[model samples]
Target: MIVDSLDIQKEIPLWALGDGEKVIQREFVFENFKQAFEFMTLSAEYAEEIDHHPDWSNSWNKVSVSLSTHSVGALTKLDIQLAKAMDAFASQVNSKN
Candidate 1:
């Protein structure tokens, strides 16, 4: 089921573009390309383990991510869970800087 924007905002302060949309978005910036790639590696592993992949792109030290459940045609619990996990991964990478 699609989640409410209010609940998602409360859960993830950094998430945006969730106003009746199928996706929730966030951008993570790292200290350098190496650090950014490391974040992607970690996030990719977790995403594969969970079987939920993000629609994302990387530009230099920045990673832009959008989470959505295409099968459901909306953002579901999986997107929220993955978003939280990605945020945690980004936090770890940021702290190592």
Candidate 2:
């Protein structure tokens, strides 16, 4: 089910909330490329496990992520969950550096 935009706003206020098709987006920066890759690797495993992938890209020490349920072309719990998981992974990766 598509999650309400208002709920998403309340849940992750730091993320950029776009209207309609733009969806939710956030950028994570690491101390180095190695740390960035670590975060992505962790997120990839989790995404695969849940069968929900993210639209994301990495360059050097930064990663940009956008979350939405592509099947329905809308925001959903899966996107929210993946966003939070990626956030946690970023935290863990940053802490390790």
* Predicted structure with the largest TM-score when compared to the true one: 1
List, in order, the clash count of every candidate structure: 0, 0
lDDT of 1 by residue, 49-80 (tens): 99999999999999999898999888888888
* Tens-digit lDDT track of model 2 for 18-44: 657447999999999999999999999
Where does the lowest 10-residue lDDT sum fall in candidate 2? Answer: 13-22
- lDDT for 10 in candidate 2 is 82
Backbone clashes in model 1, listed as residue pairs = none
Give candidate 1's error at residue 22 in angstroms: 1.3
Lowest lDDT block of 10, candidate 1:
14-23
